[model samples]
Target: MNALFFISQIIGTVSISAILILALAKLFSRRWRGQAEPARSRGYAVLVTGCDSGFGHHLARSLDLRGFVVFAGCLCPDGDGARSLTLQSSSNLKILKLDVTSDEDVQQAKKTVQENLPEKGLWAVVNNAGISHWAEIEWSTIEDFRSTVDVNLFGCIRTSIAFLPLVRASKGRMVYVSSVFAFFNCLNLGAYSVSKRGLEAFADCLRVEMASFGVKVSIIQPGNFCQATNILKLKTGSDIWEKLDSERRQIFSRQYIELATEYFLSTCRAGCEDAGPVVDAMLHAVTSARPKRRYLLVSAVDRVFFQLFPFLPTVLTDAVFSLSSMYATRTQMLHAK
Candidate 1:
């Protein structure tokens, strides 16, 4: 009885302390946070990568409508998404053929923006181009790792370096669209988590380095919006199955692959359908006088999970993930049968 009472008391005290801390933080944030005036958004030039679809496409259109000169970089300038954007958007929006993987393309984009910029220079650069793949580490190929990292990590670095001069001149913000996976690794998303984690690290370093130059760096860590963004619409596990050797295939059967794939896809599709909150966070990062260092656009449940992650015991975390993986793949059942 005494132990139970002690535990209850501790839990109560901790909950109260957490609430107080949150209240204080909110109070300070509002008091110290810089407000973005409506007029400040007008005539600002913003560059957004991967505008062919997803967040980049939406952000470009939104920014243009807000009176910012938006340079939308599309991998396929003549693609359906780009064509639709051009037709639907105002004259302030320009679509550029930008493949973040290519240095030549990035350099050309920088030149184009330089010639088009007004006296204020480029107001912001939103690095939103990225790709994701789902596969177990053993099922993944070297090319898979390279392709995912190339687009998510190296791509951002290349674009940042090319446009740093313009952003510095304007003292504008550098906003990166990262993922919640950066905070914790998930099964079948090892490569993606690795890439986003690297991105978070780079953003942190750049933020500190650019502080003296009056350039602000912000990272937008959004939770699952895979359905709205169609981020995983093109991804599948068929390729992984086909590429595996005979022995590897025998070890992990086709049924296991199908089940695992279904689990991954279903989980993704079940996430938030509305992507407006993510875009809102991105806009705030770009337009606010003093943006947050990291914007977490996750649901309340996810917010709680993120907060508890640091305090959770490693063994507990590992056991939970391990059980999840087992449930998805059913490795033990496969072996038994």
Candidate 2:
């Protein structure tokens, strides 16, 4: 009994020590989390994609106000969002008609930015444009996956290649607005999650490659901010049912589909309403003297969960997800019975 008690005590001490070391390391990090120096940022130009809404729109305005010459790139330059941005922001903000998927459009945008740039070159390119889709793997079509990847992954790649020269000249920053789904996959968001995961991989590779040059590559992984952003419309259960063929309809009951869709929508609606943390992370990545390689803009609980997931045993994690899946669809299961 004494030997067993001693062993347990040793284990406890080791665990506590490990936790303390991690905490201290995090706290003592030299990264500054403050706003960019005004004088240094005055003549620098920043190109922000997806400025039609959400983070891109907000960040463009903020950067403009902070004295950076802002190139706000929107898919529809004359759209309401872009027009409103022009009216509200300083004259320093120029609206660029940028469609990330089109090679012609991206090339034109690069030319436009080059024509207006200072001798210092483009200071940053913020790839904030992305699309989100939710459907079970089998329920989602190839087109669904392709569309999500086209916008979320390929779009960033196109923008990066087009702007690499100017950014390399300035030794500037490249920031990709990724999602927490890049960390771990969630139910029914497979297409969106896959795109984000690919984006994360791309960012990691580019980070290493850009080290030779002075360019900094950063990725911002945000948790659920569905209500705060226009990323997801409230897609109804019927929409999923309409897409399924007779065979698939037989495989999944109408009631099950309805309940599952309800669950997904409910989870999204229950997500964090404020995009403040995400925006702050993006700003820090862009303007801070020392930005982190990856910024996780999640809640404290979520941060701990995701950080720990990689270290846990696969069986244990799988079991936890299994239970979670059962819990999430308990009502549907009961109805089927």
Candidate 2 local lDDT, residue 11: 100
Model 2: residues with Cα > 4 Å off, grouped in runs: 1-39, 325-337
**Per-residue lDDT of candidate 2, residues 216-314 (tens digit):** 899998888897789995677889899999988877787877888888888888988887788788889888877789988778877888778767888
CA lDDT for candidate 1: 0.87
User: Across residues 1-337, which tens digit of lDDT does each residue of candidate 1 receive?
Assistant: 9999999999999999999999899858966885554236665799999898888888998998888999999999999999999999999899999999999999999999999986677989999999987788878888988999999999999999999989998788999999988877777898899899999999999999998898889999988899878568454567668989998888888878877788888888798888799889889999877688988888886798776775798887766676675564475756855
The true-versus-predicted C-alpha distance at residue 202 of model 2, in Å, is: 0.5
Candidates' lDDT values, in order?
0.87, 0.87
- What are the models' TM-scores? 0.86, 0.86
- Candidate 1: the clashing residue pairs are none
How many backbone collisions does model 1 have?
Answer: 0
